[model samples]
Each structure stands twice: as C-alpha cells, then as structure tokens.
Target: MDINIERLKSTLMELSKFGYREDDKGIYRPGFSEADFAARKWLMSIAEQEGFITRMDGVGNVIIEYHAEDVAPDTPAVMIGSHLDSVPAGGMFDGTLGVIAGLECIRTLKAQNIKLAKPIWVIGTSEEEGRFGGMIGAQALTGKLTPHQILTSHDPDGIMLSDAMRSQGLEPMEALSARLNPNLIDSFFELHIEQGPVLDQTGVQIGVVEGISGVFKWIVKLIGKADHAGTAPMEMRSDAFMGLADFAYQINRIIAEDGTDTTRITVGKAELKPGFAHTIAGEVDFTIVARDMDETVMENLAASCRKALSAIARKHKLMFEYEQVSWLTPMKCTPSIVEFIAQQAQKLKLNYQVMPSGAGHDSQFFTDITDTGLIFIPSINGISHAPDEWSHWHDVQAGTELLYQCVLTKAVNKN
Candidate 1:
C-alpha cells in the first residue's frame, strides 16, 4: 500500500512499448537488439530525470543509482533488479517486472525522504534468457564468465554473441573485466514471478525462494546415410530419425525410472536435414536440456542421455555425438535475507510459502559475489516466456511492498 501501484504499472507499460508485438501480443526484445538498447536508454532516461546516476557497463548491463549525501563512497550498495531482454515472443512480466519493481522501491524511498547509509542501485541485466546459454550480465559483474565462452557462444538462430555485443557498441573482452569491486555491493535482492504453478495452484501470494535449479544443456547430433524410402529394406536401412526416436523414448524411461520426480528432461529443438517426402532422413541436430535443484541429479541425467544415445546409435548402425553446451549449479538463497522476506510477508498478513525456483536466474550468479535472495509472486497458470504469461495486479502490488520493506531492512546502517 505504501508502494505506488500506479507507478509500477506505468513503468511496465513504458518498457513494454519498446518491443510490443501485435500478432501474438508477446514481446521480442532480444538482447543487444535495437529494441533492447532502446529499453536500456529509456531506463537511463528515467534515472537521470529522477536525479539518479546512470551507467552502462561493458557488457550492456544498465545501472541506476541513488546516493545518500552523507554515505561513504566505500560503503557497499544494496541492489535490486533483473534482466530487460526477453525471449522471442516472450511475455512482458518475465524480466521487466523485477527491474520495474526495483525502480518503484527507489521512488517510494524518495517519497518518504529516507536516506540510508548505503546506496540503492537498480540493474537492468542483459542476455539472461540463455540465448548464449547463460546469463552474461550477472556473471560478468562477478567476473565469472570466461572469455572463451563469450567469444564462441551463439544463439539458436546462429547469431554470434560477440557480434551482438559489438553491434551495441560493447566489447565482449571488456565484459570480462566488468567485475564489480567486492566491497562495492553488500547484498542483492531480486523480486520476480514464480513462473510456475506452485504459488497460483496453492493460493499463496508470496514465495520466498529457497534455491534455484541447476541447468545443463547439450547439443547432440545423429548421423546416417540417406536411402531411398521405396528401395531400402526396413530392416537393412540405417535411419537417423530412428536413433532420435529411440533417444526420446529412453530419456522418458531414464527420468521416470532412474531420476526423481523433480528432475526434468527436455529436447526442445530438432532439425531434420535433406527433407524429402519419400527419402529417409540422413541427419538430425537436436538440443537436450535437463534441470534439477541438485547438481548430482543433473549430472546423472546427462550420463543417462549419453549412455542411452550411444546404445541407440550402435544398435541402429548410426553415429552419435554430443557437446556439453553449458552448466549452472543450483544456488541457495541467503538465510538471513530469506528470513527478512518471510518477516515482511508475515507483517503484511499475506499468505506465503518457502519454495525453490525451477528456472535459472541472475540471483544464482550473485551468490558468488554477495549475499542474494529472491521474492516470487504467482504467475496466473505457472506460464512464462510466452504471450499469455501473466501475474495478477494484486500479487504484483503485494510483492513490490515486500521488496520495499526488505531493501529498507538492510540498506539503513544500524549504527
């Protein structure tokens, strides 16, 4: 209630304009795209208009800061923000909500004329949709991203990550040095949508995130000789498609039998080469993505995929190989910060629960550099990264208020 709900809505509306789509009502703000840069400029303009300092790091991460007149320059800042880019035809609330909610927190603090010992910074990160297979901004900020990864990565469409950064007037190597001083940021807080059914299904308003799932991805290929569909005998032909089918069936069995219920396996992309109505397919390129809250589970899932696919290739007389594209270990939220969020939800008398995130987030990377925590509001049907992905206005308001309270709790010096 103390937070400005109207301002929150208006900010989100403004950001949405940068990449609005009329077809499916989704957004297409791909990282380092012109629209994404426009959104970054819009955020900086707002910061400047509000008398806040603004800067864009080498990796295209946007930072807007509010400095107390008496605070020491060496004092660590408390940060609240999320990424600005979205997936192709992605929803509005996925990444933009956290950044907007953070801006509103700054506005609310200014309205009350409160000054903390430390600074408040709102960050708009880049490339967080795994376009390059990992979050570049947060990892760059903590100096965790390697030069090899940044230079060689590409999107599903075959767009080079380095080229994208170069087009935006940024250098990928410079991003490697985008590390923040360890003493400069004391803690980080991110308020995001649950992007799952747990909260909405259980009728909970607030979710104090306990951990984020680890993500492992592989790019696999199955190779075989194309043969005439009419001439090749069914028993004698070495079919590439058959190998793919066998892998798919065994993946299900692997997870159901060897993996836990929380484990997930997805073959989200597949391409068939030399398509012909009567010709047998010669080759296949597909991606494998597995997720779980435990790294061991993710490792086991990868092992299972390799073993099953290798056997299928041998049995079907096809060739198979895979590349481990990327890996992110699960991260646990800071205990004190998690407790702070719970206390605020209790104070507000809002229904809440402690939960783990099923998706990867920037908060997971922040854990390496500083104390980090996450706040989640319910998604309407546990849907995200799509046109219909939505969160209720009431839930948004409650989550923003909780974010405001949590920031104030650590931002003010106790001396």
Candidate 2:
C-alpha cells in the first residue's frame, strides 16, 4: 500500500505550526527550546490518540510504534525516523520528513489491514542540529553519550545541556539511560531532504546515500604587529589579514593536492582584532571546517591546511597557532542496506543515484549499532537551514513511497 500524500502533507503542515515565525516564515525549533518540546509532545499526543504506542525518551526523543497483534511482544522493531529539533529558521522538510514519513508508513499499513512479522517505530530525535556540539538524542540511543559530555555541553548562549534538560524538568544524567539495546532494533531507516543541490541539480528523484562525510574543525590564530594603516609601509608591515587572505587563496590548491571530489573546506567564521578601518589588523582569528569521506584524506587535508598557514604566516612575518576543535570519523551505510535500497529504487523505475551526504544526520549514529539506510529527496535549489528551503510535494510523495516499500519488505511476513 502506498502512503497517502495528502495525509502526509496535512501532518507536516500541522507540525510546522509549533515554531513557525510569521515574520520570516521560518521554523524556530532549536534543541530543548519550548517549541522543540511542544513539537515532541504534539507527536506523542497525536500518535497515542491514533491508538499507536508512544513515549518520550529521557533525552526528549519521541517514539511512536505500531505492533500487530500477532507479533510477539519481544520482537525486534524496524525503526525509521530523523531528528525532531531543527536549526533556527530551518525548513519544514529537513528532519521532520523522515519521522512523519515513517508515521505515514505505519498509517498505510494499518489502513490496508496488513499484519507484520515485526513492529515498526517512528522516532523524532532531539538536538540533532547540534546546538550543544552533539547529536544528543541519537548518541544517547546508540550508547555514544558520556557523563562528561552531558555535563559539559552547552549552547552558543552558554546555556548548559544539563540546565537545558533541567529547565524542561528532565534530569541530565537520565540521558545516559536512553540507550537502546542493539538487539531490540533490527535496522534503522531515515528519509531526509538533501540539504544540498546534488540530487536536484542532477535531475535525480532519489539519492541512495552511501555514507556521511567525516568532519574536522580548527580554530586558527595569526598574530602580527598593529600599526596605523597610513604609517605602516605596504612592503614592511606584518599584516595578519594578509596572512589569512593568503591561506584562503591556497585552499583550492590544498584540495587539489590532498583531497578528493568530496572534500569540502569552509572558513565559516572569522574576526579581526582591534577592528577599525584605520588600523592594521594585528591578529586574525578564524575557524576552518573540513570534510571528506575518508579519514586518511581528512588527515591529509588537515596537514595541508597547517602547512599552508605556516608558510603564509612566515611570509608575512606573523606568528600562527591553531586548536583542533572536533573530529567526527566518516560513517558508511551498511553495504547490504545500501544495495537493497538501490534495488528497491530500480523496482520503482525511479531516476536514482548512489551519493554521499555532505551533511550529518541521525542515521550516522545508527550505523555501528544496526543496518542503517538513508534516502534523500531533493531540496529546491539546494537551500536548507533557511526560511526559503523547500522540496516539492511530488518528490516528497515519491520518497515516502520508497520508504514504505523498504519498510514493508523488511517488516512484513507477506503482502
């Protein structure tokens, strides 16, 4: 049975109201905020009303399940979902699509009076946008969270993760108890809007993601002598901005020498000390975020960046320093699961591609614990985490259909 696209659209429209800002028309459900919790409760409320088993985990993940009467109580479940929380002003489809799509899958099965060999669970994960430097919900569920991380994590506003949980009447340490027994889950599936332009630009209707790229972040500093802009001779000045500029220019060269087609380097943030147009920048502080599918390539890219900055600093007669902030190793989807998804796509006669996701998702955490598959629908113009991000409704229908097929094949004893 195919998912009801109209029903899916209606549920998604209802969900968009929780954190919708009329001024900018963006969703504002950042992790652990009132809007975020409200959205979670709403999912639970609606699922319970519909006679589905539902609960919220300690870390605020919303779990909605459908268990056929014939299925044994202890049977492993097929879990499918994406994050519930969104980036500030994020689009409607980014994370919620997977959760709602899974919900629709359950609705379709029930509507068709289908019995299952396994139960199905749809989860809305928490803090996946990484407000506290981690995918808290998925990590907790996968037993990847630690007490130290729970205590130390904080938002950009300096609100501790513990405090955030406390404000919502949840004990911080309870997050550690949220881990799922790996045996209880048969596999995990996630359907998400490609927050990038790849699928859309290539005219592909479906993306069978092979893996999520690894990432590294560095905070770099360049120090030089400050002087009046007019008095400092152009040839003799130790200009920190010059050093930073030179490094920026070498990024392409570094990628060409040490990176592959999937490598990405971005200078997302930067600041010039003693800010004034009339003063030479004595110090430049910036961040370097690099991503690649392979750990070895990531290492080479990191080394290339360090070497380039050092040479640029020496040429400008400046001192350079950098701190490695964080590193996440690449996660590959289970090979069998990836191939299974591709086979399903071919069955549907859809235009599909095997691709790599440049962005992170909750599915990555499930890779080590269970067979995991991530599917992508295109974002219009590849825009996401913004007010204007969108995916066509038809594409959404196609994706949910594929998800339903996969879940059906895995969870049912017979059609």
Candidate 3:
C-alpha cells in the first residue's frame, strides 16, 4: 500500500499553481484560456519527464501510455482519467483529481514491476467544463464528436473553439479525424470529488456512482414597455423585470409540486435592460437550467419550466421567448462495472455507498465507447467550484487506491 498519499497531494497542489486567479478566488482555467494551455503543456512535459510516452489528439488531449511487453499498440487499453480544464473560478479538484490519481496509479504499478496483457493510458482530457458545451477531448477519443460540433462551438465569451484549438497548436478538423476506434478501449475509469454532502455527511470513504443526471438549459427573454419610473404608476406599467421576478419566485414551487424531488431548477443569470437608477426596465434576459436523473422526469421538468414561466409572463403582461440551448439525456454506467467497483470496495474494507451523480462528468461521455465507472471522495461541506473546495487527503487516498487497484485488476480482465 505504498500509494504515497503525500505525493498525490503534492501533485494536486502543483496542478493548482497553473490556474490561480486573484480576482476569481478559484482556478480559472476556462477551456482554451491561456492558463488552460499552460496546464496542458505542464501535463505533457511532466508525462514525458516521468518516462511515459506522451501523445495528443487533434482536440488537445494529453495521453500518457504504459505498454506491457506482450501488448500490441493496437490492442484495447484500459483508459483512466478526467478533464484538466475547470469552470471559471472552479475548485482545484473538480476534474483534476482523476488525472492526478491516474498518474499515480501508473507510477505505483510501474514501481511494482507489474505487467498486464493490455496497455494502460491516463489522459487529461481538454475542455470538459461546458465552456463549449461538450467534452471535446474525450468525445474526440470516443468518436463521438463531429467537425461541425467543433467548428460551430463557441464559449460564453464569444471565443470560437476552432480559434482556441488553433491557438494551442491543434487543427480542429484533423484532430476530430483522429478519433480512436471505440473498440480499442476495454473500459474507462474516473475518480472525482463527490461535490455533494452525501458521502461527507454519511462518513463514507468511497462512492460507486450509479448514473449521471441529464441537463437541459435555456435562455429566456421577457419583453415589456419601459416607462418613467417616477411618473408611471406601478399598476399601469407592464414591467418585464416583474415577469422574470415572478418566475424566480414560483420556480421552486413548480419543481417541487409538478416535478419530482430530484428535479433541480436554476436561474443562474439575470440581466435587466437599460440598467439605470431611475428608469423602468424595458426587458429582462435570464438563463434557466434544469436537471434530473430520469429522462421522462427531465422532460417533465422542461415542460414544467415552460408552463411556469409562460404563465408568469402572461400574468405580468410581458412578451416571453425562450431558446433551447442544450439537451443531454442521462447516462447510466454499465452495471457490470458498477458491481465490479463495489467488489473492489468490499475487498478493501472501505465504507462505501452506491449513488447517483447530480453533476455531469466526463464519465458520462465515455459510456458511448466502453463500460465506464466513477469513484468519488467526499468534499468538505460538499463544496466545490470555489477556492475553498476541499477533500480530506485521507479520503482522496482511499478513492485513489480503489481506482488504482481497480484499473490494475480490471484492465487485464482479472475481474
């Protein structure tokens, strides 16, 4: 059990150094940002330094490989890792822990002089933070990406993904053309922070993920007349802000009453037209996001959103329109893989729980290519995507060990 817990912590800390931001209070390696490319370079340079053969696809995934003597290059390898990029002001461990732990798995396995029948590859996938609404690197590897998806995608800041990839020395079209055959990977494994209170409150050291939630997002605009704030009577004015406000007030009730307990609704952004001190707001713009673990429930939640907001707009005498931004169905991990993970936890004698992921992850994308499983460590106070985000080093070590042993055993069909 020479897993080197301190070594894992040090590697995580070192990764944190690349994407620090003073104003944001968390790491800001938004996809294709300068800091993200720096992190990418660091991953490649470090992999080479560690004596692992390094390579990249057109979408800028950094894969470090360990080839067993009898394993052919074309043989299906066991894939392990998560993404390297982060949301704006995101926590240090959100998508990073898996990659670091995968590296450690490779390190420990090589140190033990263990050889397998198949190769092992640890990847730091690029652009998984929804900056472009897709996990670019992982999808490219899984053959789930299309050239149109990349060429047409843009971040919130209006940066085209094509331009971003080119800036980092990758050709978007050619990189997509380099997609690996799905049959080449036996399975994919990822270890991540729980990012919720379940494991922390229950004192569970490991979480075997059941499935990931489906997400749907929309941009809504409420339109109304702008009038003089001092002269226009409140009763006579058709205020768009009031329309947006009314929806915000009733959203919780809508989901709770009309949808299931697992359904989640978020009004993540709001903007008032002509934001001024004394003028009546003429229009409102906002973003709506909904999530649920079941496809029908997810669709029902979407219908509920439209029902709730449209009624609010009618009552407020405001024109309303919403555009669907994205819709992704829930992804279930292979049951065999989940059971296999549970067996590993049992063998290790670690307290564990089988649970669903409220947040989407790269593992959801991997389900397209091969069996996928996720391991989660607890987040302190269930906090993530902020500078204060943390997982106890002990919990981190336990999750990593589970991942290490799982890969070493399962990659070779020893399961």
Candidate 4:
C-alpha cells in the first residue's frame, strides 16, 4: 500500500516546531535537552491519541507498536525507526525523518485495516546527536551500552550524562534495562535522507545502503615553548601551530598513499594556547577524525597519521601526544536485506544505488542483532546538520513507500 505523504509531511512539520529557532531557522534539539525530551513525550502522546500502544523506554526512546488481536504472543516484532535527537542548529530532516516515516507506515497500515501476523514497532531513539556520545538509545536497545560509558560520558559543556538523565527524571544506570532479547526482534528498517550529494547529484531516487564506514577519533596535542613573536628568531623558535599546519598539509598525501577513495580524514576541532598577537603559540590541541569502510585501511590510516605527527613534531622541536578517543569498526548491512531492498526498488520502478553511508546511524548498531535495512532519499545540495538541509516531498514519499512495502512483506503472514 502507498503511504500518505500529506499526513507524513504534516506530522514532520508539527514535530519540527518543538526545537525550531527563528534566529537561524534551525532546530536545537541536542540529545536529552528540554526540546529533545519534549519531542519524545509529544510523540508518545500523539501515538496514544491515534489508538496505538506507545511507551517510553528507560533511556527515553519512544516506541509506538501495532499488535493486532490475530497476532500470536511471543512472535518476533519488526522494529523500524531512527533516532529522535538532532545536532545543535541541525536541519529538520536528519534523524527525525526515519522516526516519522516509521510512524507514517504504521498509520497507513492501520488505516487500510491491514491484518498482521507479527507486531510492528516504530521507535524514536534518544540522544543520537553526540552531545553525550551519539546513538545512546540504539546502543542501549542492542545491548551495546556499558555502565562505564553511562556514568562517565559528558557533553562538550562538561555536563555529565548521569546528571542529564536525572535532570529529565530518568535514572542513569536504568538504561541497561532497555536492552531487548535479540530473538525478540525479527528485523529493523530505517528510512532516512541521504544527507550527502551522491544520490542528489546522480538523480537517483533511492539509496540501498550496503554498509557504514568505520570511524576513529583522536585528540592530539603538540607542545612547544612560547616566545615573543618579534624577538624570537624565526630559525630558533619552536612553534606548535607550525607543527599542526604541517600535519594538516600532509593529510592529502597520507590518504593518497594509505587510503581508498572513500577514506576521509578531517581536523574538525583545534585550539591554540596562549593566544596573543605578540606571542608565538606554545601549544596546539586538535582533533583528528578518520573514516573508512575497511578495517585494515582504517588501521593503515591511523598509523600514517601517527607517523606524520611524529615527524612534524621533531621538525618543529615540539612534544607530541595523542589519545585515541573512540574507534568503531565498520559494519555491513545484512546481505539478504540489502538485496531485498534493491529488488523492491526495481519493482517500484525507482532509480537506485547501492552505496556506503559515510555518516553513522542507529541502524549500524543493529547489524549483528537482526536483519537491518536502511533506505535513503536525496538530500538537497547534499546538505544536512544545518537549517538548509532538506529533501523533496516526493523523495520522502518514495523512501517511505519502500519502507512500508518491506515492512508489510515481513510483518504479514504469508500462509
């Protein structure tokens, strides 16, 4: 059955208002913020009003499920959704689209009086914007969360995760209780905006994601003596910023030698200590985030980065140190599910591409636990995480329709 794009659009627009700002016309629902929590509660309330069974998990994931009378007990459920939270000043469609699309799928099924052999659950996962470590809700549901992470995690502002949870009336350690038995879930599906230029540039209507890239983050420090900018001889002074600049310049060469076409390395954050126009920078602290789909390539890239930094430090007469913050191995979507999604796309007469997602998503966490599929619609100008991020309504409908078709096939009894 086809999805109602108008209904989906209306719900999306209504949800966007929860964190919208007039200043920049952006949404500010960082994970576990007041806006994020309000959006979750609103979703649960809306689902309940529509005659669906809805509840919020301990970690704040909003679940709306459909279990008809004919569906047998102990049957596995088809869980479909994405995270509900967004980056600060993020666009409206980033993670919210997946959650809302899943909701629309359920609505369409109910309106058509479709009978189910299995239960279908639409979840709006919490804290996926990395304010206190991203994909918190998904990690909890898939049994990937650790008590250490829950207690020690903090945002960029130094607010602890436990404190954030308690502020929202949720106990910290209780997140562990949100995990579900792997067997209890039949499969998972997520429909999301491509958030990149590939599909949009290629004029493809759908993207059947094959895998997600592995990522590693490093916090690097380069230390040197602070000296008077004018008096310090250019040859004698040890400049930390020079070391950092040299490393940045080597990134392209590193990738060309040790990385693939898909490999990406970014120095996203940086700081110079003893900031003054008359003083040379005494220290430079920067972050290195690298991504690649292959584990070995990730290893090679990391090694090259370390080598480059060591050489740069020696050349600049600076001390070098780095901490490996986090490393997530690449994950592949279920082969069967990937093929199934492409086959369904062909049946729908939609142009499709099988590609890897450069960005992380909640579905990556479910790869080992159940069959998982991720559908992607084009993002206008390959933009996301900003107010300008957008996907056309027709693309949204097509992606949602594909999700619905897959869910119907899996949730309905074939007998």
- Please estimate how well model 3 matches the true structure, expressed as its whole-model Cα lDDT: 0.85
**lDDT per residue, candidate 2, 17-82, as tens digits?**
989999999999999999999999998998888889998889988899898998887888899979
Better of 1 and 2 by lDDT: 2
Per-model TM-score versus the true fold:
0.95, 0.88, 0.93, 0.93
Over the stretch 59-95, how does candidate 3's per-residue lDDT look in tens digits?
8888899877777778888989799999877889999
- Once superposed on the true structure, which residue ranges of model 2 sit more than 4 Å away at CA? 156-158, 219-246, 271-286, 309-325
TM-score for candidate 2, residues paired by index:
0.88
| Per-residue accuracy of model 4 over 1-415 as CA lDDT, tens digit each | 5688998999999999989999999999988889999999999999999999998888988889998887776789999979889887899899899999999999989999888989999999998767775788999999999998898777644699999999899999999999989988999999889889999999999999999988887778999999999999999989999999999999999999999998999997788889898999999888788999999999999999999999999999999998775677789999999999998888888899999999888998999899999999999999998999999999998998899888988899543
Worst 10 residues of 2 by lDDT: 149-158
Worst 10 residues of 3 by lDDT: 149-158
Which sequence of candidate numbers ranks them by TM-score, best first?
1, 3, 4, 2
Instruction: Give the per-residue lDDT of model 1 (tens digit) for 6-83.
Output: 889988988998888898898999888999999999899987998888999999999988868988878899999799
Residues forming the 10-long window of minimal summed lDDT in candidate 4: 149-158
The candidate that wins on TM-score is: 1
Note the residue pairs that clash in candidate 1. none
lDDT of 1 at 413: 65
